[model samples]
Target: METVQSQSKNSSTDHHDHGGIFGEKTELYFAIISGFFFFLGLILSKLTPLPEWTSHSCYIAAYFFGGYYTLLEAIVKTRKGEFEIDFLMIAAAIGAAYIDSWAEGALLLFLFSLGHALEHHALNKATKSIEALGELSPKTALVRKGSTTEVVAVEDLKIDDIIIVKPNSQISADGVVIKGSSSVDQSSITGESIPIDKTAIAPNTKLPKFEEIDSSNVVYTGTLNGDNIIEVKVLKLSKDTTISRLVKMVSEVETKKSPTQLQTKKFEKWFVPAVIIMVVALSFAHLVIEETVRESLYRAISVLVASSPCALAISTPSAVLSAIARAAKKGVLIKGGRALEDLGSLRVIAFDKTGTLTEGKPRLTNIIPINGFDKNEFLEMVLDVESLSNHPLARAISKDINSEYGIENKHRSSDIQAIQGKGIRARYNGGNVFIGNVEMMKDAKITVGSEIHQQMDELLQYGNTVMLVGYNETLIGLISVMDVPRKLASQTLARLKKIGIKQMIMLTGDHQRVGDSIAKQIGLTDAKGNLLPEDKVKAIEELQKNNTKVAMVGDGVNDAPAMAISTVGIAMGAAGSDVALETADVALMSDKIQSLPFVIGLSRESRRIIKQNLWISMGVVALLVPATIFGFANIGVAVAIHEGSTLVVVLNALRLLRYDLKE
Candidate 1:
């Protein structure tokens, strides 16, 4: 059955870890209950010539006590049209009862229950490393209103709300300090294990230290407030906060199957039927040649039990669970097991242009003023118009103008009209300022200088998309804003290629120049640009048609459809939009592109482990079936071997929990 969380809980390791604890407790409860019935049956069987009816009742009770859950699960699965290992085990148990081996039936259930308990316990221990992740913001924030402190839910906060931070309190929102200084622990957010000192940071200054204790003017989310009391103005609300975004991204990591998982499923389709046929044929031949139907039937049951698909059934999930836990340790959250399995077979990975490979946030990479206009004047004009707009280019222009010119545009604009898909038109300084793309300026009859065109063209070569901001009939300046590449992007791409990835491709909605520039920088073999979400899906389908398994990496609404269409979809959880995260097959919890190779390595290792376990299980069945049929092994030994095979398969699959990858 599919399981989904009812509420958007804090993305904590606790949410996932608690499921294991639940399973473990349930197992222990079942085991204890089964043991009680087993003892009761033993007592009743020997007590005072107990009636045949009474003895049978006790035996049945003991059998049902241990196997009832399995029976229920089998029925549920039947309704769902999936006949699984649980059904096979139930059939085996009932067959033992039919053979008048009541005690043996009870014993088999007991052993199976015990094995389940052990598996849950082991799985719980293996996943313990992920328990610390998903710690959320403290439920409450200390809001400071004119020096009076009051506690409130973090979600209730609004922009510019002044919040107070006490020593050792987790910072509730992303904000800047208005007062005080202290050292903050930021290890949770940045993976640095040091307390950073934060003095009042100016609006635009140098980078803050990773760690130093001076909480005077520091601001970061999920970091500890130092020993000094400080006031902060909230820059973003809870839903828009960094941790909130991360939690959302984590929740959405891709859940689709990778190529390996699909192959495993396909293999099982054939492997299961073939093994069943072989087991039936060998048993029936022995029945025709050997003396007793009882012995032959027993041999057949042993073969069936020995060749149980439990190992195969368990292989993919165990390996994937282990891989996900390992990723969590490194600050990555892969949502589904299928995604981990598919990541290994990815031949080409398409990336979303805006955010997946680059910092989604655009910055002013270049600002060129034309026609003898003073750069500052051009900047002021553009910034004044852009400050009134919310487009990415506008924001980038605003941030750049403020950073470079040391002036905040306080002058208000009148009659601002934002043209959809073009630019913003506003009355500034008694003139119409058109700050937008060339289309916008052309529509407004604005002409740009030749030098500005040359500068814009040059910016495109470096992977930047330039926006033209013009006044009246002349272009004021060209603001070159590009999606910033991730710091580890180049090295991450190189590592991906080294891991046997061929035909690297990049897909984006941006212009061709931007896509080509990024593709070249990242050593891509090909690049596609100006693609919509559906277009991305077509590209993935094309790759599949050409026999190239592809993984699409994206971080926006536009990537959601492509993610669902790819062989493997990797969502950039660190910067991904909520829909992208929820739809992708695998999500990299952090914005680290390097984890792609790590995931692939883990999947390949897991697939190998699954194959090894299946063979081991089959080998046990092959050896035990012959011994039972030839009268070399008694019912006792046969039963032991049958049960032991199951145990061996389980133990082999458990090895995936500690399986290490070279990546």
Candidate 2:
């Protein structure tokens, strides 16, 4: 649904971002002049001795001010061979004047204009909130020159330029931390509840490409920095920052229409002409009964005013716009009304296993000691050897051990060596320690008993990589590790089910056991693995064969095909990636799983409000036309009721701006 809004002076982004709803002084002056003349003419012509034409001159002044934009819109629609509610409203107001109801005609245009202005004002408040997100990025950055730092415009900053971010300040651009350690609060851009710890990238660590990144070093524009200074190396130009991409998406929402809005447009195409035909037939039908021409035309004008369809034209877009703005505030970008409507009806949601479900890095899950070594003693041996190595597996093990035990590395290792096909080992505490696979332990003459072997077999079934630790040529412990599910993955799935999703599944390129292991941890109904992008699309098709609405959630690059096939394609971690922003129907800027349930609930709420607005608007017309025909209502009363319904629907749609799903 759409309406022709009369803009006062400027509709620029800066105007909407900072200015109040009243636009300028000219709008207020015109409104005051129109109301002053309308009331003066209505009372003077009735109570005092006044020439009728003189009173009409006052009414004409009211029409010129109040109906200026409405008349212009009506004329434009007419030249294009289109008829809208504005044209119908102006015609009915002029018909009232033909019967000498000049005061009532002025009242009609005044109320209609006021209703249109109010609706647009209310819609502006919702849109302004979405635009406010862009304002979070500061205009200037403290750029670091060779000797001293100089303040520069964010737009003037170039790639590879170093900028210094102060404590509790908004990040200036998309960049990486080169020096300093701090926790960057990404809630403004990514909606991650917790602030991410940011540290300078190590000199030895290989950095991933900007197109796909997950490092403690990466920082984005519009996110708040914690209480520490950080020197940032700009990775992107100012225009290509995540904040700019989001601003572009906000502008795009205006052009995209919901299915309901399109249907409303189709209804208006025929509804306007049909109302015109009915009014014409009614005029002649009264004349056939021998009623006077003036009286017949008068009644026809009343029906025309009653059947204006003002509320219907604005029913869907108002709600859709509000919902989109609300979702954007929560760090979820819904492309348009169609996606918002489709998301509400999602029956199945398929998740990509790597980044969507798991944290995409191996984490230690279990550590079991064998023989005489206690758990801490076993971990101390494992940490001492693994911390010296640089393998990915070794890093995973050492990180987990350091996080859990806070080991100070009491024993200084002397002979540390990384076996080519196996893991690493070192001499520590006057004893030889080994950390590797079962084959490495066995090759070193360490006993692998039935109990330890059975334990390793059980861990393998859950898709865990078991690493054996040995000391003095004896078995010490086994450490099981794998990529673990995200912290909120299981809770998010349960919340989705609570909101009426029927099934949850996982589609991934990982092994079947790994996929199932993640599914079990995250409460998914099914898990499918060893699937390429094409296979994911086929899986989406298979789910859709049951005629259910399916949604695909992924990191948004490899899963684009699957997302295209699903009913709703949601991209996770879209804050800085352009491919994710452009590909998915819904882009969750934050990589948090918690946002999934929130977006789903919001879409459902918006859909419900749109349906409710339709009912309220159509229901008013059902009661209105018959009352006007039976002489139970006059032109003044019908005009008042029509504008009243318009205001009612607008206020109802505005309810979505403050909508929140309480868990």
Candidate 3:
């Protein structure tokens, strides 16, 4: 088996891998040394005039190097009253030597050790996809101090320190770009196929609520700088960067065993001992049958080697780990194998409309001034009250007022207060100003004029959230804001449908009209509106009662319970919520809605590959066991077929690294 090296207790993440390597170089070097001595022994005996003792010495040296770690592990396991695949392999080689076939035994050890070396090299490359992410960040950064810049180690970089990211270099920390402009290759962090242009924002600009880092103004660690230089003020310490958190999450996920992997471990627990007992039976049965001990012993050893279960042990993990690494490299972080496998079997998928299906950011669409009030002055008053609150609609109004109306800060407000569930109130320019819904206007004892009332109803019917602007106890203006559906929402849902998801529904806390409007725009089959967090959970539970697996996709925190109960919980990277990123079963780091299909496609493919690998492995065993017992296969043929299947399982898993989502 390819796992001879990993059989050592010291070199593996899971000793029961039966056949896996973490790609350590020391084992590979020792395995090479073992092979060299084995070949030297063969050369001395066959082609050289060396004495027989010299050849024997070479064979002894080969066995010592090849069997050192395996022998140690077998002894340690025996003392504990345990059986390991390592002991099985050691028994096979020693039995061959007992039959006066030192050359055959030495050859077995040589090939086993060399097989482990090659497995180490190949599996190492497969696991390196994740290791490489941690390595993408530069070792050092150029920090600006006063008027001079000096090189500082990345770990030494502190918050609020100004760092200069020169052109064609990696950004060393996550920070806001206070100066300069450039495009960045954010694919490693955001999975954006195109380089995004990052322009500097004012140092004190207030970001929207729930945004982790400003996508347009903030540069993340490990993203490449473009042709122009940009100066970034570090927002977090080196260890707290997004890249570091992802690395930490990956480490945590590695320890979690998937259902199949747990089953495999249990299988190994009984299977190894059973194989040992079966070999013993074969060894003794030959005596009653009057067969020669050497021939019987050789066949039993061959069966032991043939049925090592190396390929079966690695079938799930190799594919699972490689798929995880591939996803992480592309900016999709699947927390563990459970999430990966769950993604494959989703029957019904529900989406949170606000951030998951539509752009969570709302934009002011229709601004109307009522009763001959000055439009600019009305907006100015509205902005004064709106700016005092951080509500989505208020922010949307402020953004439109500042960008479109281009108003100078003339109107000022005092005693501003936010009324929960209604809107905001403030005293502006010698009178009270209100910026909220109809309920807020009603609460303020202000009535909408007949014409303005008609328009508000029309906006509401069209799925717009209307903000009523009241001034001095009079209805002054109306601002309609709408959250646009994501550009890829329609296409992404269609892709999910094409991929055999039985149902797609939108779950939203927004009004039924608003939810249905967006759902229609995105071609979703159904929309459930005004759903509280608990309501969402109940909805998913109802779907599950129908014998369908439900997947809940949301902003992560608000949908946590629903996500917990669903078959899979997917968090959008756009949420920028740390709770969302750290807690979701799967996090779409790219924040691109189009990547959803890829997540499903890859997990399903990975599961299929695992099954294929298992069949290939067990199929080889099914044939080899019978053939070895019937005297049709010897140690060499068994080793060749058995180890060849292990390599095939590993190589098959590695193909996931090259898998790409089709457009």
Candidate 4:
């Protein structure tokens, strides 16, 4: 787990993060230092015995303390052969100092510093909920040995280790409940407010029901252990756990950006130069007509200072920050501004079948056996083979077989081979034994009869993937695995439709039946199956070619490439993969699938606000610049309107904060 670092005790925004030394502490120190010098300048200037030079010295000190970073940044930009708003601000303020308007210069520095501090505060506040989730992550897990318990780093916990979870402690890992029951506070994970009552037989067993574990039986990392202690078997370790992945994903999201945000930078490349031209023209005209160079320059500086686009600069990010803040409040962590922009434009949302729409756990749904073999014999032999394998399908077959026979398979064989996209082959009892689907058996020249084919068709109708196992060229038994759709999957898809998304589809690496089953259940119009990561990307490209702005939502390591290819790549169960988070444009913190629509709606609303702010700012600037040149407006009026418009733009952007987004 990453620590959130804090340097000063008095600091309001000190949380340890993995962002190294340049996080909250550095920002706070700069703001505090600037604040100190500002008051120091004011105080030293009032000393009775001090000469003018000493007062000037205090102003210089204030500038160094308050404006040093800005000055250095501006000079660095100059070295890079690019001029920015920083250069313009510094030039105007230095000119104020040259004219001996020390108060004006100091005021300029003070206001700018205050703005910087506020921006930092706003960003800090925006990320607090996400950081809070990180802070609440468990550092240690309890290892239970017989009747004794030992605490160790969460990373040290292993699979099937029974861990004791005390009341109010963070659940240290994801695991099944072998024993105890309690109500778990899953609000952090699901954005659901109330505690969910977890029992012995809660739904979806492979992935532990973090909501249903008996307070006495199971615990999950980042979930609050309830009023009653729970005993749980850890199925995954700390680094591989869901919470750890989410924290890292959130960190990586700061860098995964949206296309619109990048385009906005390009927009600035042109917009900034045009604004400079307007500011220059206003100043030149004032000098020619008014015959007062000093007044003209001051008015010109005010125009530049007013039209600096600082408000416009913050315009896009403010909506982005607000969207992210709103999403975090709802347990959705969108990575950056661009993701928010793209979410608003989504026309099609392609979901992965395994985890995005399905529950991702397989169950034995059907079985078919050849004439010489009964269902039991076939199951027993396949379970014998599956018992030695660790794949999800293997574990599922084993679990189903063991439950039926009440005996664990102990048979072992050598030289086992798995055929990609098919099944397994092994040597057992001095004969060729196959323990996979019909494709695997057929490749080995095993005979398939009409009965097996009929049964396979029946299983396919029910959306089961049937595997035919054979020995000595004769079919032994058939194994079928079915993945259940998520309970809310269809409802979530319908909600997206309500939010104006026209196309909803499912993409999977599973067979066509498996994919189609889930797609139909979720009411999707299209379902593509047996796709690799590259195939998924190709599908996204095809959708985009059809003029559909597609968003691919997935949470697996395999889904990362497709996520990167989509117009907006959204990661479901975001805390599972760093690559998914790093590559995907948006992240859902927990398993609740409904927030996708909420975030999309919020983005559309945010874009509306951004457009409003941009128009209002531009409209006022267009009107006021001409008004100032013709003497219809004085310098003071222009400054007031200019500052007033900045405030108006900010307040208009703030309207996004009031949006209602709930499940």
lDDT over C-alpha atoms for residue 384 of model 3? 76
lDDT of 3 at 162: 93
> Which of the predicted structures, 2 or 4, would earn the higher lDDT when compared with the native?
2
Flag the better candidate by TM-score, 2 or 3: 3
For model 2, the stretches where C-alpha displacement exceeds 4 angstroms are 1-269, 279-305, 321-336, 390-392, 410-434, 438-451, 470-475, 573-578, 585-606, 626-632, 650-663
Write one digit per residue (lDDT tens) for candidate 3, span 10-91. Answer: 2343332343242356556766778788889989999999789887888888888777656656777778787866677677
Q: Estimate each model's TM-score.
A: 0.60, 0.60, 0.61, 0.60
lDDT of 2 by residue, 1-663 (tens): 433322211122222234334553333345456667788888879887988887899899887766765676577667878787677778877776776767766766665565444333433422442345456578999998999999999999999899999998989999888898777766444333235568887665666787555556889887888767899989998888876765554445433434444554676687778888878987886547867776778788888766754575567667877888898889887776667888989889998876678776678889888676787777877877887875666778888888877876655676898664466778888988888777788789998898888998888888787888888888878888887888889998999999998999998866788878778877999999767556777798899885788998877334655665577878886322344445567888767778988888888998888889888877877788888877788776776776688788889989999999888
1 or 3: which has the higher lDDT? 3
Alpha carbon lDDT of residue 364, candidate 1? 79
- Local distance difference test, each candidate: 0.63, 0.73, 0.73, 0.64
Stretches of candidate 3 exceeding 4 Å from the true structure: 1-274, 372-377, 388-393, 404-408, 412-432, 439-446, 449-464, 482-484, 508-514, 529-535, 574-583
What's the CA error at residue 275 for candidate 1, in Å? 6.9
lDDT string, candidate 4, 201-295, tens digits: 44445654554444434445777755556677787777766556554544444344344434544654565566667667766765568567766
How much is the lDDT of residue 298 in candidate 3? 73
Residue pairs of candidate 3 with colliding backbone atoms: none
Q: TM-score for candidate 3, please give it.
A: 0.61
